[model samples]
Target: MGKALIAGVMRWQNTLDLTMSPGNVVAKPLEHVIAANDANKFIAYNNIPPDIPKIKTKSNSKANKNKC
Candidate 1:
């Protein structure tokens, strides 16, 4: 019975160690991708490119246009 109690305590300690370990939590790679996208959006909103032409859509052209 003493050996069984020690074994149970060791198992509980191992479980606690695993849960408390700092390396157990990992960030997903997509988090970096989303951060990069946010940074790009911030830069784009702050600085508008002058070379790109502005598109103006006519209300009546929807019925005749084949190319989008």
Candidate 2:
């Protein structure tokens, strides 16, 4: 397995344990960093840019307007 994949797996396991145990506020930042690095590594290896889906908001103006 690649370094990134290994790192990711380790971080995931750590995060899971932390979540299950509770009260590890001090480790949250490090956990986040690990997760972010894992994501970056995966993205780099896949050679695909991250695609964040856009949220579509519905406008109520048309439906709320008084009909003349």
Index of the highest-lDDT prediction: 2
TM-score of each: 0.15, 0.19
Lowest lDDT block of 10, candidate 1: 12-21
lDDT string for model 1 (1-68, tens) is: 01222463554221233223345433242344335453443223323344456454573244665776
**C-alpha lDDT of all candidate models, in order:** 0.38, 0.43
RMSD of each candidate?
18.1, 14.8
CA shift of 30, model 1, Å: 2.1
Q: How many collisions per candidate?
A: 0, 0
Residue 51 lDDT in candidate 2? 75
Report the error of model 2 at residue 65, Å: 84
Q: What lDDT tens digits, residue by residue, belong to model 2 across residues 1-68? A: 11222463554322235444335674464455446454553332222235745444453223565659
**How much is 12 displaced in model 1, in angstroms?**
39
lDDT of prediction 2? 0.43
